[model samples]
Target: MQSFRERLQAFNKCVCDGARLMVGQGDYGTYVAHIAKTHPDQAPMTEREFFRNRENARFGVGNSSGFRCC
Candidate 1:
C-alpha cells in the first residue's frame, strides 16, 4: 500500500504527463534521468541545450530560414 504522499505524487506525475502529451512538449526530466541511468559516466546537457537539440532534431532547423521564398 502506498502512502498518501506517494499516491499524491504519482497522481500529480500522471496529470503532468498527460498535460505535456496534450501540449506536444515532452518531459525533459525523463530524458535526463534516462541519460543519467543509462550513461552514468557521461555528463548530460543543460536544460537549454537539451531543448534546443530536441527542437533542431525534430524540425531539422531552428528558424524559418529554409521556408523563405525570397
Candidate 2:
C-alpha cells in the first residue's frame, strides 16, 4: 500500500494535470479541495486553508474511526 504522502502526491499530480488540461498550469487548490471532500479518506479544507496547512497537515484517509484530521 502507498503511504499517505505517496497518495497525496498522486492526488496532487492528478489535480495539476486536470487543471492544466482545463485552465493551463496555474492554481487548482479549489478543485483539489472539492475532490478531497468526496473521498472518504481525503481531508476537506478550503482552497486557501488547504495550502496553508498541507505541509504539516495530517489526514485520516486510512483510519476513519477513532481518528481525526490534524
Measured by TM-score, the strongest candidate is 1
Off by over 4 Å in 1: 1-24, 62-70
Residue 54 lDDT, candidate 2, scale 0-100: 40
- Candidate 2 regions exceeding 4 Å error are 24-70
Per-candidate local distance difference test? 0.76, 0.58
- Tens-digit lDDT string for candidate 2 (1-70): 9999999999998887776545323344655766767785876556566444543333333554534544
**TM-score of model number 2:** 0.33
Question: Poorest 10 consecutive residues of model 1 by lDDT?
Answer: 61-70
